[model samples]
Target: FQVKKKQFFRNFMTITLFGAVGTMMSFFTISLAAIAIFSRMNIGTLDVSDFLAIGAIFSATDSVCTLQVLNQDETPFLYSLVFGEGVVNDATSVVLFNALQNFDPNQIDAIVILKFLGNFCYLFVSSTFLGVFTGLLSAYVIKKLYIGRHSTDREVALVMLMAYLSYMLAELLDLSGILTVFFCGIVMSHYTWHNVTESSRVTTKHAFATLSFIAETFLFLYVGMDALDIEKWKFAS
Candidate 1:
């Protein structure tokens, strides 16, 4: 809720690095370890590629759980780190997952590793730029059109529309929509928020908080229900 906290925001760089590099390392480590363990245990026939796929799935972390548990009053560093890492990790894992989706076991070599890393960096940078660009563009339009002077309802709609449009545009272009939306939010907060109508500014803030809470609640509930689904348990084995 308190985005103005400098101390909390200072952990952004550390969290970004952890989410990007740390996630990739963890994916590899977990996949290799899982393969070793599964092979030893003679579990169902799952090879290294399968483990990698599974690792990719678990690499992305959601900050909703962490944020819900740790209030703003608690350790700011931990909260910021968790939030930042969650954002970065989601973007990283999406790129990593897509990169490894069609991976060939026979082509696993030094060159493949280098290529993967190169592609990952490119994807991350491009996707980030897409989000920032969209956000800036939206902000510019609002400022130029004096959207804030308009009705508060119209301002709210414009803001939400720009945000969702950025996401859809990124996905349409075969880019990372998650990263695009994340960066779009950043741009909106930094630029567009100020350009919005004064009345709508407060409305937008509460709207975001409420929507985020509802989405997070439903997400966790869905996960919990899925976990308890006896019918789907057989698929795991």
Candidate 2:
């Protein structure tokens, strides 16, 4: 939503190159290196799938902190590049991870690889379509129903619910909820935002911001707590 459509389109190629292609390269490089290193070490035997899974897990990049520090108005191009790449990168990693989950190291054939690629494409495309469709439907409802005329609260609630609905629907269909939500927000900001009342706009903006902050805080807290689990570390070591 924060990303300008013009900037996104302008940098679309670069973003795809870095996000999808670069992520795949990183995954392969990391997996191969881990496999080579582990083969020479005394650790328990790990299959190629295990190394690939680790690669898939670590290939995703989060640039939220960098984005927070960068002023979008001052550097729109750079901001869009970073933001777009981050979103696509995460989505690609997720799809790749899901594809890898069904991969068989023992059956490393062309058909298997093609199937993996097909699955990734299907998930990515389907998730994006679902998000866009949901967003457009939300905008149409707001523009046609006169919900804003009755109460801004209803409009705000409807917007939030539609966003959640898209995410949940994607997850239910075994697609990428992150991509679904991201595109849903973009569409909502473009179409639905203009259709709602000023009060509903402000309320939805602040509510989403507050929810995002809380979610991020909880995410970091959970990660820190998991990292500090001494018993889990002891078992691993």
The candidate maximizing lDDT is: 2
Model 1: weakest 10-residue lDDT segment is: 1-10
lDDT of 2 by residue, 130-187 (tens): 9999999999988888645547888988999999999999989999999999889989
Give me the candidate number with maximum TM-score: 2
What value of lDDT does candidate 1 attain over all alpha carbons? 0.81
Clashing pairs in 1: none
| lDDT (C-alpha) at residue 237 in model 1 | 62
Quantify how close model 2 is to the true structure by its C-alpha RMSD in Å: 1.6
**TM-score for every candidate vs. truth?**
0.89, 0.93
What C-alpha lDDT values do all the predictions have? Answer: 0.81, 0.89
